[model samples]
Target: MADRKFALGTFNAGIAPFPGIVIDDTVYDARQVVPHLTVATLLADWEASLPALTAAAARPVGGGISLSGLRVLPPVTPPGQLFAAGANYRQHVIQMAVAHKLGAEGADPEQLAAAAAAEIDERKKHGEPYVWSGIPSSISGAYDDVILPGGWDDHDWELELGVVIGRRARHVPVADALDYVAGYTICNDLTTRSLVPRKDIPMMGTDWMRAKNFPTFFPTGPFLVPATFVPDPLNLRIQLRLNGETMQDSNTGDMIFGPAELISYISRFAELRPGDMVITGSPPGNGSHWGRYLQPGDVMECEIDGLGVQRTRCIAEAD
Candidate 1:
């Protein structure tokens, strides 16, 4: 194993975004080594390109450009299909339930906590993951500006660990699912909470597309760190700060369903292709819980260990 791990990202030197590898503070253009490889193509043939990418990362920084001032693009552009797990973190689910007064009304804190724990354990034993799809067009660069859509007031952030698939997979078992992953990245699953439930058709339940697929709703990547380098994805810390205040701070270990379980569950119904992303659910602590929804001119910084940081500025939707 190499002492230094490899990460892939897109940088805009001119007009178009080009695939590159970040080595420390400098970016070595992977196109220099494989001129025709786009980030999508690299992921499509991840196993074949691993050697070349590793070699490219080991090369000297003579031709590498400083990362400063370079515009970063979403690591995976036009990802094949975006999947998100909802209420997949034990604590997050508990927090939401309690905050909304779902079941624990008038119960003491101890009883509420115990009941939540029991429910989590029961779900782990027999519950299937709650997975939903998102439009690829919703994706934005890690450092890009997030547009707060007009008429929406409850935009909230859910920073999650994003798993990028390296191969086509269908009906994959949990034990073997991790083998299909290419790498991990950071994704802030922005949501418009007000649009969640369809009041017109209350029985129809949540409308993820309307709530999550707005332009620039999903802010992803600074880099895609290969799965091999991430020994334990569940052990990584996930944190999101609003402006300068820390809002979300938790670890992936709190997830109700880990990456392997999430992939296996989703692959049973959908054929996950190369460049398809499955965002493992965000941990507890979101604006909804704090009554601090996003406002224009706000800045959000999200970070996951080894996957790199994303800084996004919020601005009102243009007329």
Candidate 2:
């Protein structure tokens, strides 16, 4: 047996979704060794289950199945809570601000970018993350189709890094926040740009529910890579290709508030239990910023360094 890097995910061939340990291109049934551990349960008892999972992945590879024919499912279905950060990436925030600027019309493009960069630096020094909640029902599998709902057609993609919580955290300090994380995954947080800002009530700002929580809007997980494997989550590369064209290409190093700070900030409001998630904000390129949005038959491929890739197709809702 050899100890090596592996990921955790859920798969379905014909029956119910089952947790598996992924080594290279093969997947071994997790229940073969750890009968009591599902992806959700493993995170609930993450510290205690690590050794067993590691040993399981080290076993001989004969009984494992190939990954090609199986259907990938959401790693953790109906997680307890789903929290997300907004405007957290430096370049993304700046790009959005500049793109939708109501003032500073006379400034050059370079000048605008510099001014936005400076503002981001100031915000980093004394700012808290912009966090919001999402319903569990919106989650779809990595390879599933993203349904572009009717009555609102401005669907846009925001590929982000997702953080999975292992330990219960309440009012945790920033210094020790990372101790509660179990793993990380890829998150494709699709938004309805047309419904984002309430035209009915301009003072209401964003309507996150209508804009973000549509069914099958959140496509997540090809694999969940443990924190031990991702030593530097802040420096990983995040890239997204829509219809075979690179739309979003940036690094997590551009995040103004990292997972530690975001978690610490959120812990003050509610308890962060095992299987809960926090999606770090998206990077610089988004469909809305490019004046393009998801249409029927569009394919989006999202990838993060170390974690596996997620490929989702877009389908428009019927008339």
Candidate 3:
């Protein structure tokens, strides 16, 4: 068998969507060879399932399905305990703070980013990552349409690197945290910027639950590239374009806390189980910084190096 890298994705195969081993454009059903194989089962025993998946994926199997005709679903269906990071990127944190407090009235995106850069330079060297839980139902497919919730016009795009856990972890040390990672995928952490702050209760601060977890808020994965394929997750390029205009262009290196650090930090208080997804915070170039927000008929093209692309369209929710 020729050496080729394979990723796992969920696709509609008749009655329901099932996990399939994806190698390039062709998707092969491993269930034909390994009975009752699902994404949950594979992740439940990632170590053992990986080799089997690799072998099955590479085989010149009978009647392999074409990925084009199939409706791709979120990589991990009923996605495991989702934990998302906030203000984790150096520039993103700066941009978010500037827009939220000072407003982007006259500031150019570059000026705002620079001002944020200047102030965020004094960030704590030993700060902990900010993480919050999300429901699996909020997840949508990579190519899915995003319905902007009614009456909220400030929907924004936050292209983030998603980390999938392969092991049950608790109090995991930063140095050894990457070992618990199963694979990596792209996640668009959609948020409603206008709803972020709480005026009714100033002390309560951000309202992440209302701002972040709307339906189809998290567009995750065209594929789940195994950790082995991604030799250096920190160096990958992250980019997003709105209506063919480049919006966010940054690298994972700008993250104040890398995937390992974020995972390890979150695990200190929460037990991260297999299939759980950790959204490593987004980089700069959000709508808030640019003073633009999502509008109906807009197209968001999101991509991360080697992880494939997600092209999602936006539509206004009906009243």
Candidate 4:
């Protein structure tokens, strides 16, 4: 209904979080249009709320708040379930393989890259995505501070395109998977690389709970841009900067498993509900590759096309 696109976010004006819509640069409290609408409720009935949200965006603002200096919460607090795709980016997987010596040391970079690309193609043809679940408590707002866990020295950043599920999805086909997506957002899948593979449980392998589920480990959302606005999820640019230095930069096209395939694959085993998030894997250029880990007082700014930017400050956890 509004002339421009719409995005959803939660803002605190000193009290509880309230649903707000971002049009241009200002945030209009959506309660002025629909008093009962919250981020969770909007996702639960996303399609039904669009009309009212659009109308609300066009209405006159009597006391709309400026976004500057305001506290912005995660668009969807305590999302239904958070699913993260691992090793889903072609270049990132190649980088990891080479870094971990999965490929021969003497092999040429071009040859290795070719081999990696071939491997990814084969996997997409016959393999399924690697999906891992994260605790809801790990989520924090896009602008919130990230706490570096005590005794951990390998904290890393993995900027990703976060897909928000709008409808209940089970056994969805790849062709129709995007239909279930409510919108898209930005998510920083922060990791404690040292705690990933457990030595105590060698056979069990990765311990995501300990490595990825710390409080504020997942910093997400400046706003949730509707799916319709994002014409092609695979063509977006994804980048992250650490204290003004660009650390991770790549395109969504590098993904081994695109958003549609990922949604379809995950739905086979788990029912994706509204407000649930599927974080498409991050691109190449992680701290491990650069030999630089996150430090206290470091700021991370991540952005994707259409989706708003997320600026997060890192701090050390209290001992």
Best by TM-score: 1
Global CA lDDT computed for model 4: 0.89
What TM-score does each of the candidates earn?
A: 0.96, 0.95, 0.92, 0.95
Candidate 2 has an lDDT of 0.88
Decide which is better by TM-score, 2 or 3: 2
For residue 107, give model 4's deviation from the true position in Å: 4.9
lDDT tens digits, residue span 29-136, model 4: 877776555788778888877777877776746577789847999998646799999998998988977776566678777667777778888998988899999999
Better of 1 and 3 by lDDT: 1
Ranking by lDDT: 4, 1, 2, 3
Local distance difference test, each candidate? 0.89, 0.88, 0.87, 0.89
| Per-residue C-alpha lDDT of model 2 across residues 1-319, encoded as one tens digit per residue | 3457988988887987788889899888887767554688878888877788888777744488899979988887555589999999988977887787723788776777788888888889986789999988898899999999877668999999999999999999999999999899999998999888898999989999989999888899988888889999999999999999999999998999999999999999999999898999999889878998899999999999999899999998877
Per-residue error for 309 in candidate 1, Å, reads 0.9
Task: Please report how far candidate 3 places residue 269 from its true position, in Å.
Answer: 0.3
True-vs-predicted CA distance for residue 189, candidate 4, Å: 0.2
What's model 1's lDDT at 265?
93
Off by over 4 Å in 2: 60-62, 102-108
- Select the stronger candidate by TM-score from 3 and 4: 4
